[model samples]
Target: MPNLLDIELLRTFLTITETGSFTRAAEEVHRTQSAVSMQMKKLEEMIGRPLFERGARSVTLTPDGFRLLDYAQRIVSLSEEAAAVFSEPELQGQVTLGVPDDYADRLLPRVLQAFARSHPHVELVVRCEGSSSLGERIEKGELDLAIVTKCDVGEGEVIRREALNFVGAREHATHLADPLPLAAGPQTCSWRRSAQHALESVGRKYRVAYTSSSAAPLISAVLAGLAITILPESAVRPEMRVLTERDGYPALPPCDIGFLRARHARSAIHDALAHHIVTRIGNLSPAVLADAAE
Candidate 1:
């Protein structure tokens, strides 16, 4: 039999091609730059061609590189599809789930509790992080499923898209001078962008009064009157008030929260969990569903 090409090396090659830098690809794959280079070298030797043109400051794919990339992507995608179809067993084992911090606190607990009550034998492992981080973990196969906000779809199944709304403390003064102070999350957060766009569309200037990756601090800042924040209605607690809608602030376009799974994951439990989330949380806003249909 001929020497078989390594799937891992192909994956590394694809990552390098997509990111356009070996250093960034190494960071993404959690390998050293030298290790990534070695993988590329091994792949080139196997294929009997140099795939990339190495320059002093930059690297670009050669003509051969483009051809190999097409094949590599197809191979990886087919491999994942095959794995998903053939490897998945009946639901009876653990399922690792990732959820955004706000969702975990406000909406997920009930869904999880219900799932636990029904499927006591299946262990559920939950990871809480920002939506972007959650999506990254799911893509890397570190997580089975994730609930995220407005992630670039790229090429994957989108399980659901929930609507997000602007929220604020009911007691805070509705009126503010130019450049409204906005409480926000890290730059990667989808809601942060929505808040900024909402303000800008209405000809309102804004400044970031506070920034945190975690949900607790962001909520605290809102409660303390430091600044207003935008969140999904499902994430809003009973105590929080709708300052924007009440004060006649123009409504922001609804944020789309989505659930995603690895294309290659082999677990019936993942399917079941995804079905549960989409049916339950996805249906929370009839208005959103109607709008999407329209």
Candidate 2:
């Protein structure tokens, strides 16, 4: 008999590769650096091959690591799919889920597809709104579950923490404008505030060249080279370029993603969906995994 690869280990492996830093991946997965290293050692032992060429500051994948990456990604995704498929087969109810526009495209599909496949009888009522609005909705007992941003010190259970960065079109010099042209959201948006604060801290003059409540349009504005905007590092697209300190863009605070559940009631369906959201989104995202494989 052969050793079957562990999905959990594979997930951790993916995290290490995605971050390229054991310490960083450990923090991402809420584990100690030593623990993460041990896990990787275990994975390497199972494969009978070294996975990483460990350097002082970062780690690069070995050829075997690259080969395992493809398998790990598929195995982890399929494992999630399998879990979702077999989860709460008897539960039948409705769950109203609220998500902000930014994460709808990046994070929703897995939840939607898995929930739909796993619990077909349960209706997942999804609402697209800003995090502030979503938080208000949860408090008002209008939403059963919500993925919202946590800007303040402490409030909700944070599921994901992502790097916030200044992003512009790949070929654009919009960031170099005299009063740097910025494409951002309304005053209430956390990301917008982060960008503003980062710029203000450095006394960088900037003007709002474009404003949109939705992330999709703001992304469009950046792609068109109209302006630069703040985005999650993982969410940056191929057409976009991250503006670093060399480009005079100050680093913004990391974005915190929190999950909310309505106080109205707690049913089996609600708990199941909530668990699903936390598990899927709490870990390194599929986007990071794809980038690692690339």
Candidate 3:
């Protein structure tokens, strides 16, 4: 008989590859790092090849690992689709979801509340993090679904994408001698990266005055005049000064917002929730674009 490959182990492998950190992968799967490591070892032995190259503080998928990723994603997606078609009765299952911190504050609460009201028996677990982190969690099956900025969606399916804009203090002058002082999130934030690149593309020098993964701290930094930051228009408050013109400063390029669902585990609750977010966000797009135009 051919060597058997466990679907669960493959799912774990995919998570480890996407996160590039065993520790984070373990956290996503709700397993200890050691256990995750052991599962990988078992998987490698069963396959007769190492899937990832291990280092002291980092990990990367080997060619074999990359090859497995495509299959893993497909298998997981098919499994979910099968469950969706065959499962009976109303959807009732635990759904672990990931959302970017900024969206969590401005948009997610309403979506979750609505979902809870509609699916009263479903348990909802939410994790708020940067887009990159959320992507990793979603890939690993740690999250049943995710709302995040567009980044590496991997070979997994994409549900929807929205454009993001740069938002700053309304009263701040556009002309600055130094690199624009920026209040931003950690390095993994897509908005922060977009802001820096936009400035650099225009030959503008900018410094990060504040960096925090949390939206509250980043927004506080912006409000305190420590620095201006890029944010989605939906996240901007009416009280703050905003720059809508592109005269002195670089034009903030649009970033994509993506909603994703795990291919492997199909949950009707997650599908419904994803649909809800896409619909709500679509309804808000015109306003978001209008704000950016200002």
| Model 1 global lDDT (CA atoms, 0 to 1) | 0.70
Top candidate when judged by lDDT against the true structure: 2
**Clash list (residue pairs), candidate 2:** none
Clashing pairs for model 3 are 76-263, 76-264, 77-263, 169-241, 170-241, 170-242, 179-205, 179-206, 180-206, 244-294
Candidate 2 residue-wise lDDT, 52-104, digit = tens: 77654445777888889778877886687677666635788788998987888
Q: Which regions in candidate 2 have their CA more than 4 angstroms from the true location?
A: 6-44, 47-88, 152-154, 284-294
Q: Which ten residues in a row have the lowest lDDT in candidate 3?
A: 285-294
Ranking by TM-score: 2, 1, 3
| Candidate 1 per-residue C-alpha lDDT over 66-166 given as tens digits, one digit per residue, 9 for 90 to 100 | 77876776676546545644555434788888887877887687568656645567889999887777777877889888777755334344444555666
CA lDDT for candidate 3: 0.67
Q: Name the top TM-score candidate.
A: 2
Worst 10 residues of 2 by lDDT: 285-294
Stretches off by above 4 angstroms in model 3 are 1-90, 152-163, 170-177, 283-294
